[model samples]
Every structure is written in structure tokens, then in C-alpha cells.
Target: MNGGNFMSYVIGIDGGGTKTEAVLSDETGQVYARVLAGPSNLNSGSRESIEGTFLKIFSEIKNQQPELFQHIDYCFAGLSGTENHVNKEFIEALFKRLVGGQFPYLIEHDAVNALYSGTFGEPGIVQIAGTGSIGFGIDQHLNKKRVGGWGYLIGDEGSGYAIGRDALQVIFQHYDRNQKETILANLIGKYFEISGDLKDIVPTIYQAESPRNHISALSKVVFEAFDMGDTDAKSILQRAAKDLSKSIEMILEHFPLSNKQVVLVGGLFNRNDVILPMLEHFLNEECELILPKVEPVIGSVIAALQQINQKYIPLQK
Candidate 1:
């Protein structure tokens, strides 16, 4: 980590519930290669899938940019569900095999990357609403608090998966009650190519290898429907915003940050027009809600650079 050579570089990895993004950059902020792979969140899928995701990412870097891989002086990975000691240890061991332990390394929860993405390593709150959702905050004193990353079943209320699940719920409820037909059923049916056969949805959804991804992907359709003036779709998003705001409120109520900078990351916030206003409506007016232009992987790069040089700040472009 103390090496002071131009040849030395760093690898920054952002492992989210939906995908893993990695950046290979020099100490001077020169990016040699950028690689993307599947989800690597510890709670995302089975252990095998998570391992395969990292394997694919590391292998791609080593094969595509061998020189960059060899020159990696420090490695930093911001992974979801790593706040637990056991999950942290598991990922660290995996990194040793895939990334090699020769270089100094750090493993942190994905929220750190989100916070850094917006705050540049300063104290702030990050609400990660993707395939799953978690409310994470770092106070002025650097005290960290996390809430509502309980996966799809119990939490992740405002996530893409949750939105998709809500869509599914309304459509199926319409079918069950024999009520006035909703456009959501028609749209979702067409999306999945079920041809209006309600029975077909069960197997098509349940039988998939990754049902969560399939369901979460439906959130896109919900957003589309909202754009098309569908009341149900609009309602679903509104409800999600309420849940997301509640999660943020819980974090702020318990562990308040001096600066109410709430950085929005993940799929739901991507549609700031619909979701951002909803958040503003439910959340406090003073909360400086931010949608960062750069992705979270840039924050991971900052984390990696900080290992060797704290003053060296990488461009978040």
C-alpha cells in the first residue's frame, strides 16, 4: 500500500444485488479497463451464483487486462450484505483466491460506495433501492447505521423487485376477483407472452431460474405503465415511495446526520421524475436528496485509492 511507483494501480469493485461493476485505474485516475458482471450480493442468490459472478469478473479482468491485474497495488470491494462479520470474512476469502492476497485490500458494505459516490467519503445517508433495498447512513462522527435490507420477503419494500411484485399482485388480484380488467394484466401478459392466460403466469414466473430477477425486471414495465397514465401503476410507485421514505425516516430518526444529504442510487431512483417527487413528498423538505451523475463503482475506486494515499482523489466521471 505504501508503494510509490507510477506502475502501481488499484481495482475498485462495486458488488450490488443486481450486478457487479469493476474498475481498473492507475493512481492518477487513469482507467485502463472497465468490466461488468452479474449480481454478487451475498443475499442475492445462492452462494454458487455469487461465487460465479465474482469469478467471471476477476477472470475477465485478468484475461482482458493482464497488465492492469498484475499492477494492482490495492483492491477495494464494496459489496452488499457484507456488514455481517461472517459475510465479510467469506468475501475476503473469495477475494484472496480470485484477486490474490499480495496487495492490501478492503471489503465494505455497498452503502459505503453509495455514500462516497455522493459525499466523496463524507458523512451522509444512502438509500439503495434495486433488486433489494437498504437504508444506510454515516453520521458526522462516522457512526454507521443500516436498516431494511431484509431481502424481498420481509423488506426491500420500495425496490424494483417490490414494485414488480406489486404489479403482479394487482394483476392477479384482478384475475381472482373477476373484476374489471386492468391494463396491467394485458401489458404484463404481453411482456411475458402469456397471451392473456392467467394460469400460464404461475409456471412462467415460478419456474424461472431466478424468479427475483424476473419479478424485479417487471418494475420497468410498471414505470412504463405509469408513464402511459395507468392508475394502478401510479399507485404502486406511490406506495413504494412511501415505504422507501419510511426506511429513510427510520434511519434519520435513530441516527441523524448533521447534513441530510440523501444520495439516491439503484433502479427506482433512476426514474427521478416519478420516484424522486414521491420521495420528496414523504421525506422531510430539508433533506438534500441527490441523484449522483457517476455510478457507485467510482466510489469504490475512491476507496481503493484511499488505501495508499488519502489525499489522492479520483475523478468521479
Candidate 2:
């Protein structure tokens, strides 16, 4: 590649379980174009399906702006479920083949991109609480640590699934006690639009195709109930915050940087009104919370730029 072309552009991709997002940017970190594709997580979909998604997104970009696509000099991808070395290798090889191995690239787990996005590729801790929960950190020495990314079956203590599962348990307990209908119960019923006894909710959830996602969606109802002054709902969120805080604590135990900046990401953190204050209460005095200035996809771009020794100020909207 010529020096001018090499210095012109880069690509950053954030591959999630549900969808994939890509950003095309100039050397100065100015975004040129953004594209969306289907899920590319190897654990969630087949190799062919993931490849197809990437091809489709890339084709769109090429067709829309051929010059920009041609100038893309570096690619950095953060993919969910690529934590295993073999899986990561497969993805890297696949992209290399798809892109003709022309541009240099790096593939890493999605959490790494989130961490980079939160900390701008610097040393800091990041806690993600979306459909799943995990705490990741990097120290000034470049040491990395992870806490509680075991998925829904084992861990994900402070995730949306956890909060929804706890809310379901509370609703069932109310049903078993034959007590007056609580706000949580009513909210659950309305959210699910169930017409019969609440016990039917058990089969509705248990028999769902994607039980994790189904349960995670119910977290919105829990939040609504909390806003309506439901004590049980408040307790559930509080416990979730405490659990997430514990994950942060665990990561801190490994890094332990004074006045460490911590970044919170994912859908659960969207309810900052409920979770942020609780998280602040639980975090150590030396830990400070910082909001993400850009989305994780842009963070991937930042990481890609770092690979080439390029620096760009992130968007701070």
C-alpha cells in the first residue's frame, strides 16, 4: 500500500451476539461512515452465517463509498464469544481471507473492545451489565484481569437476566403466599400479557426459545415497578448493584490503582438513576465512575488507531 493510502483510513468492528457494527474512520479519528450487520458471535451463530454478515456489511460499505473502502488500511474487530484462542484464530483467519489479507487487523473478545472504549485504550476498569455481566481491567503495567463473565447459567450476577430472574422469583413467591397482587406481579403480567393465573408464567418462560433474552427483557418491567415505589423491585435492583459492585471489587483486587477510572457499559447501566448511585455507594473511594464518551464500536476504532501508533480524540457527545 502507498504511504498516502496507508495513512488515510481504518476500520473498527464491534461484533455482538445480536448484531455487528462497523465504523470507517480517517487517521484523525473522524468517522466517515457506519454500517450494521447481523450477529457475528461464533458461539451464537454458524461460521457461514457470521461470514455472510460481515460480507454483507462490507459489501454495503464498498458499494456506497468505493474510495473510502479502498483506503481502509487497518481493521480491529472485537467479537463476542471469541474468548477462546481457537475461536479467535478462526475469526481472524476468516476475516483475513474475506478481506484478501491486504490490511492489517486484530481480533479480540468483545469485552476488550468495551474496556478500550471505556478507557480509550488506557489502563482502567470496565464493568459491563447487559444481557450478561463482566468486569475487566488493565493496569498501567498492561496486566489484564477479568471477573464474572461465566454467562447466565453460572454467573452474570448483576446482569439483566439476573435482575429479571430475581423479579420472577419474587412474583412466584407472592403467588405461593396467596397474598394481594403486588406491583411486580401486575407489571409482569402486563408485560407478558398473560391472561390466566400467574403460575402460567412459569411455562411461558421455561418454554421460550431464548429464555435468557426473554428473562432479560423482563428487567424493564422490574425497573418500571421500582419507579412505581415497589419495595421488592427496589430490593432486587439493590442486590444486583451490590453483586455488580462485588465483581468490580474482585477486579480491583487484582489491579488496585488509586483513583482508578471505572467505565460502566451495557443496557443495565441505562438505568443510571437506579444503578449508578448504588454502584457509587459500593465502589471504593479511590474508584471513580466515568461515562463512555462514544459507543463501543467507536472504541474499537480507537483501538485500531492505537495499533498503528495513531492518536485521535474520541467523540465526546
For model 2, the run of ten residues with the poorest summed lDDT: 1-10
Q: What TM-score against the true fold does each predicted structure earn?
A: 0.80, 0.90
Q: lDDT per model, in order? A: 0.82, 0.83
Cα lDDT tens digits, model 1, 129-151, are: 88889899988776788888888
After the best TM-score superposition of candidate 1, give how far the Cα of residue 193 lies from its true spot, in angstroms.
2.5
Clashing pairs in 1: none
Top-scoring candidate (TM-score) = 2
Positional deviation of 126 in candidate 1, in angstroms?
Answer: 1.3
Clashes of each: 0, 0
Candidate 2 lDDT by residue in tens digits, 109-172: 7777787776787788889998899888878776788888899999899999999999998888
